[model samples]
Target: MSLSAASRPELDDTLAIRRRTLTLGLLTLTYFFSYMDRQILAILVELIKADLKLSDTQMGMLGGLAFALFYAILGIPVARLADRANRRNIIAVSLALWSVMTALCGLAQNFVQLLLARIGVGVGEAGSSPPSHSIIADLYPVEKRASAMAIYSLGVVLGGGFGTMIGGWLASQYGWRVAIIAIGVPGILLAVLVRLFVVEPKRGLSDAARVADSSRMPSIWSAFADMWRNAAARHLVLAVTLTSMIGYATSYWGPSYLQRSLGFSVGQVALIVAPIAAIIGTVSGVGGGRVADWAAKRWGIHAQSWMVGLLKCAALPFTILFFTTDVPAVAITAYVFNMLFANSYLGPTFAMLQGLAPLRTRAMWAAITLLVINLVGLGLGPTMIGVLSDALTPLVGKEESLRWALVVAVSATPWAIFHYWRAGVMLKRQQEMAA
Candidate 1:
C-alpha cells in the first residue's frame, strides 16, 4: 500500500501524500490487472484459432473489434457517470465485471460465444480507464503529471509482460481455456481491495482550484466540442489514434509472427517478449514521461509533443527492420529498439491529453480520447492487419502475409509523427496568442 514506489512526498500535498500515493499505486495495480486480463488472449491466439477453426480475421475481431467497439462506445457514458459518481466504486465494479467476463472467455465453445465474451470484457473495461485518469489528475499537478502518469503506464508494460508469459506457460501445460480461467479469478479479490482502500480525491484538488458544481456540469456534446475546438487536443486525437493502430496490430500479431516466421515457440515468445517488454518497455514508458516532463520544464509544455513525436519517428525504422528480417536474432533485436521508442509516447501523450481538459470534464475528455484510441486503434488495428494478411495470402502464402501486413501497419507511423510535430507547433502558437 506504500506508494513510495510511485511518488515523493514533497511533490504532493504533505498532509495527505501517503494516502494519495497509495491510491495511485492501487490504481496503477488495477490498470496492471486490466491489461493482463485483456492481453492474455494474444498468447492463446493459435490455440483458439485451431480449436474454433477460425480465420485470422475472426481472431482479429475477437482481439480487437469485438472488445474495442463496446469498450470505446460505452466509456463515454461510464465516464459521464464517473464525473458525478464515486470513481473508486466505478473502477471496482468494472474490474469485477471484466474479470468475470474474462473467465467466461475460457468457457466459450464456439466463435460466437467467444466473441460475445470478449465484448462483455470490453464493456466492463470501458468503465475503468476514464475514471482512473480523472482520479490521477486530481492527485497530481500539471508539473508532476507526466511522471505520475508514466509510473502508471508502467502497469500496462508489466501487466502485459506477465500476462503473455503466464498465459503462454499455462496454455502449454494445460489448455488455453484453463489458462484464461486461472488468470481471471484473482482480479475479483483485487476488486474487493480496491473498493475498500481507494479513496476518491476531490475534483481539482491537485490544482488547488474550485470543483465545478454537478448541477451545472457541461453536456457531453459540450465536452466533445471543447476537445475538438482545442487545437492541441485535436492533434493529440489524430496522433494517438494512428500510433495505437499500429501498436495494437503488432502486439496482437507478434506471437503468430514469431511462431510462424521466426521459429519461436509459444513458451519461447513468452520468455523473450516478457523480459523485453517488462524491462525495455518500462524504460520507454517511464522514460517518455520523464523526458516529457524535463522537456516541458526546460523548454515549454509544447516541447513534450516534439519529444514524443521524435521518439515515435525513431521507432519506424526498427519496426520495418523487425518485420522484414528473416533472421530471428535480427528480428528480435530490432523488436527491442522498436518497443523502446514505440512505447515512449503513452505516458507523455496521456498526461498532455489530461492537461488539455477542463477540471469538470476531465473524465469526459479521457473517455473521448480513449474512444478514438480504441475505436480506430484497438478496433481496427488488429482487424485491419488480419484482413490485409488474408488479402495477401494468395500472393505471399499464409505465414509470410502476416509479416507484410504488420509492416504496412507500422509504416503509417510517419503520418502520426507529422501530427505530433504539428500539435507542438499549434500548441506553441496557441500559447503565444493567449499570452
Candidate 2:
C-alpha cells in the first residue's frame, strides 16, 4: 500500500494543502507552548537570581546544562519510541509531561528545587521534535517540506515572544512563580487537542521508494553508523548544532543584555524588544523557508543548503556589530537583521536532515540531530557565555562583561557558516548523483 504520486494528490491540490496546513498548525502550537515552558526562565533571570541568591554560573546551569543533560540523553530513546509507536501519542504525552513539570517550577522553594524542575521539563520535552519532523516529511513532498517546517518552526518565535511578554508582565505583578505557572497551564489543554485531532500520518506517505527498503529498520547504532557514513548528514548536524549554540545563547541572554547593557528594565525589555524580536523571527522564519524552496528549484540540487550557509556567513558581521553598540535602537536594529538570517536555518536544516535520512530512521536521526543540538548548543552555549561573563566581571564590571562575552559567543557563527558550506557541497553531490 505504498502511496505514489498517482494515489497521493499533488501538494498544490486543495485537499492535500488543507490537511498539510492543519497538521502543521497543531504541531506548531504544541511547539509554541513547549518553548514557552522552556524559555520563560530567560525573562525571569534577574528575579530568580535575586530570590535564589544564585550566581550567573548557577543560573546558566539551570537554564542550560542541567536541563540539556536529561533532554539530550533521553531524546534518543524517546525517538526510538517515536519510530516504532504512535508519533501523535508521543507528542501528546510529552506535552502533558513538560507542562506539568513547568507548572511544578512555580512551586520550587529553592535554587535546587527549580533546577530539578527544569530538568523534569527538559526530560519531558525530549519527545517532541523527532516525531513531528517525521510526520511533516510524510505529509508534504520534498519540494514543499521546507516551507511546511518553516511554518511549524514559528513556534520558536511565537513561544519566545509570548513567553517573554507574558513572563515579564507576570513577574512584575504576580512574581516569577505565578509567571511560570500561568504559561504551563494552557499546554495541558493543547496536549488534549493534539491527541484528539492531530492525525498520525502514515509513515513515508510522500516517498514510498525510500520506505520500501525494510532493511533500513536497523538498531539505533546502525542508524548512527549510517549518519556517520553520510558526509552531508555529518556536516549538516555540526553546522546546525554550532549555529544552535549561538542561537540559544543569544535567545537566553538577549533580555539580560538589553537590561544590563542597554539600561532597560525587565518589563521594558520584554514589552519592547521581545515583541519586536518575535515579529522579526516570525517573518524571517517563514521567509527563510520560502527562500530555501525557491533556491532549490531555481538554482540546482542542494541549493537550499547553499542558501542557508551563505545566509549565515552574511549575518556574522552584523552580529558582531550588534554587541559593539551601546544604543538600544542601534542594537535592536542590528539584532533584527542578525535574527533574519539566524532564524532561517532551522526549517531548511530540519527538512534537509529528514530528506537525507532513510524513511524509517527519520525520527531517530531527527532525535540524534536534536540530541547534539541540546547537548552542545543548549548545554554549553549559555554556560560558556555565563562563565565568560563571570570571569570578566572583575575586569570590565558586570554589564560590560556581559557585552564582551556575547561578542565572543557570536564568533561561533563563522564556524557554523563553514560547516553549512561543507554540508551544501556534500548535499549537492548526493542529489546530483541521485538524479
Per-model C-alpha lDDT, please? 0.89, 0.87
Write model 1 residue lDDT over 1-435, tens digit each, in one string. 468845653444454455778888889989998889888888888899999899999999998999999999999999999999999999999999999999999999999999999999999999999999999988888899998899888888888888898899999999899999998989999899999888777788788655555668899999999999999889988998999888889888988998888888999988877778889999988888888999999988899999988887788888899999999989889989988988978788889888878888899999999999999999999999889989999999997999999888988999999989988998888778878
- The C-alpha local distance difference test score for the whole of candidate 1 amounts to 0.89
Using lDDT, give the best candidate's number: 1
The digit string of per-residue lDDT tens for model 2 on 244-317 reads 88888888988888889989898897788888889989998999999998887787537877888888877887
TM-score of 2: 0.95
Off by more than 4 A, model 2:
1-18
lDDT of 1 at 380: 98
lDDT score, residue 30, model 2? 92
Give per-candidate clash totals: 0, 0
Positional deviation of 187 in candidate 2, in angstroms? Answer: 0.4
